[model samples]
Target: MKKYRIGIVGATGAVGQEIISLLEKREFPVAEARLLASANSAGRQMQACGNLETIQETTADSFKDLDIAIFSAGSKQSLEFAEASRQHGCVVIDNSSAFRMDPLVPLVVPEINPDDLEKHQGIIANPNCSTAVALMGLYPLHKRFGLKRFIASTYQAVSGAGAAGFDALENELKAQFVPEENSSTATKDSPFPHPIAHNLLPHIDDFREDGYTKEELKMKNESRKILGNPSLKVSCTCVRVPVYRAHSISLSAEFSQPVNVPDAKAAIEGFNGAELWDLPNANRYPTPLQYAEKEDCGVGRIRIDQAFDNGLSLWVVGDQLWKGAALNAIQIAETLVEKKCLKWM
Candidate 1:
């Protein structure tokens, strides 16, 4: 196997940091590893592979010699630099919404559609964390029953918003100790509209004309792309929970044929990136707290849905920072290499 030269944009941010750790943890063949950040954050040293390397300022020249560039920067940054990175002959796996909807770029979930990697024009888009987690359960069932529609309610962790969201939750919870900051206005500048400590925010992103938040729409749009189901209807409600890591989604998916609980469990058990953990009698189900930092997305609370004739209800959870973002991007890069779509260094 030929080692590839890799670069990471947004190396200091939440998802970016996870990509760094995953690349090391997965033992990705690395001819060289380069870290890049904005000018303000450049010059900092990150310890990796038994050595400390200085983070370079991102420039047009940053991707000059790299084989793959993993981007976790915001959409605007991705919009501006992804093409530049690709122009420099680097394959960009972007963890931003900038290119997911683009006809030329592939929106991929390796377990669901690794074949999408073949259509990439040097850029591959990662699905939203909530969308990614929910489909882990939904896709397997779809394979058996043929998916037609889905309804989902997501319990997303604070970390999904990045470091600011996590910091806001941590600080607000800390403010409770001061005895004078218990009021709602104490965390007014927080990422959420209300204090997210011990509270749930129904809104996850900016409200669209239809009243669905951007995060909610992401679930609808992204799932359709990943599953190659353009007619797949998704109704989603994304809620921000006080949890700090994994994201959980409660969903009811209707299929083309009648669904069975035993068959659903078997399908999930056999799925590549999913697990069946439903045991109501034992009161055991997949929970965000339980699946934190884990690789496989967990599915539980499996049952036949009463609302639809051929539907199943289930709960799914996975660490968004991993299976949803970092690990997925790494897997796509690996798939490209394995298929020889991306050249070996």
Candidate 2:
């Protein structure tokens, strides 16, 4: 096996750290690992793939020696440097929304559209975390029953907002235990509009003019792109939950073909990236805590929907960090390798 040189563009953050760990955990044949961050994080030392390396400030030349670069930096950074990395002969698997809808860049979920990778001119874009989780369950059913449209409600975790979001929740939880006099210690700079502890926020990304948040719209757009169903109507309500990790989605889908509980169970179980967890009698269903680190998204609560002639309701959960961000990017990288798309100079 060829060990390719790898770079993590935002190595100090949560998703970047997860990407590094997954590269090691999956034994992705990494010949070298480079950690790139902003100037502030430069000179910081971390160990990955059995070696300690200092994080380097990203420059135009950062991808010079890398065969592949997994980017978890925000959209602005990706937009600035993704093409630079590609020009340097590195394949970029970007985890931001910067180029997802670009006709040139492949918006990919390997389990659903690995073949789209071959068309990548330079970069491949990972879908929004919630969209990725929702599709893991929805795609299997879409395959078995021709999907027409879906309505989804997502219960997302704080970690999706990065370290600050996690810290805010921890601070809020700790404040409850402290005496009233110690209230000054509580901080409220959380990216969330209100406290995320014991409360739900009905927003994820910024709202579009149409009243849907960017997160909600991404599910609709990205699903259509991945499913090759531009006509696939998706109505989603994205909510941020108090969970520390993972994301859960409740989906009601209307398929062109009729759907049944038993057949839906078979479709979910038999699918590649999703597992059937519908044993409600055993209290067995996918939840944030249980599916927090698992690679396979779990689906359960499959039942015929009463609203439409061919509608079905289902519940799904998956680790946002795994299947959503890092794991999906790595899977795209793996697909590149398997397809022999990585050519040597």
Candidate 3:
């Protein structure tokens, strides 16, 4: 029942702010919480536990006396500060792509691979937002019927790109919709390469030689790690939508054994952390607005995919900032403390 001292890196960013809010909402037993950001945001103030706290510049000394550190900064910042935090006896839960592919680092999804947390050498990597949300519905079904292959197309939000990404989408929409007198000039300062409003960009990250974006590759790679099946085949297409928050995915999964529509619906209904919203009669199913600011991912539109012999088609929606990033990190920290995986000072 002891309280632990915690620090949040990138405290001013979108995902970092969500971490602060979630920690307070969940009533985590935190003795003290430190907010750390870059020099540009060093003097900014944020609320935590009903008190105002100032953000300090993150450095090697930032982890002093902290028991657990949650990192949501970019991969570069995590790569630079993760070891320093660990050296200070702090367990780090990183929400970036920095350590996901590292052989020594464990890519974790609490429901799928909670046991991997025990083998951590002070650092746990949260999977990509698209991967996390997609797996929330798929993992449970995979347990019932062995998974043979996965194919997904993601509709990602602007917030996933950080605050600037949101700003860009706002500015683009204003310019495209508002009257000429009220509209401001749309510039290149926005996150995406082109306007995101009224447009669906088929790219999420850098393009590979094969034309798949980096975000798409993450879904393929991270899924294999979290599912504990290195041989699991996966293909994905990641797209950037104009939404402010939450992400949705259209998935088609092939199983090793034959899976019928009724059984798939039953499996989704009984799964933990997932809910089935299928009602073709009412024309209702999961959507980004339905899952935004919520913890559980909503899944629906279950049916047999005609593309593969044993394939099932489904859609999933989840708050990228919550289940995809902050909540997942907090859950990992909670699991560690609850299981006595780490000692509080």
TM-score, one value per model:
0.96, 0.96, 0.95
Candidate 2 per-residue lDDT over residues 95-152, each given as its tens digit: 9999999988889899899999888887889999999999999998889999999999
Q: Least accurate stretch of 10 residues (summed lDDT) in model 1?
A: 177-186
1-345: candidate 1 lDDT, tens digit per residue = 899989999888899888888888988898877988899988889975446889999988999989999998889889889988899889999999999999888999888899888877898899999999998999989999999999999999999999888888888787772323645553655677777876788988899999999999999989888888787899999999999999999998889998899999999999998978989899899988899888999999999999988989999999999988999999999999988898422
lDDT of 3 by residue, 1-345 (tens): 799889999889999899999999999998888999999998888788677898999999999999999999899999999999999999889999999989778898887898988888888899999999999989877977788998999999999999888888888777674334534344578777766777678988799998888899999899999988888999998999989999999999999989898888888888777888899789889888889999889999998999988889999999999999999999998889877887433
In model 1, the runs with Cα more than 4 Å from the true position are: 177-189, 343-345
CA shift of 146, model 2, Å? 0.4
**Residue pairs with backbone atoms closer than 3 Å in model 3 (clashes):** none
Given candidate 3, what's the lDDT at residue 200? 77
Kindly report which residue stretches of model 2 are placed more than 4 angstroms away from their true locations once superposed. 177-186, 343-345
Per-residue lDDT, model 1, residue 213, is 93
Instruction: Compare candidates 2 and 3 on lDDT and give the better one.
Output: 2
What lDDT does candidate 3 reach at residue 134?
98
lDDT of each: 0.89, 0.89, 0.89
Off by over 4 Å in 3: 177-186, 343-345
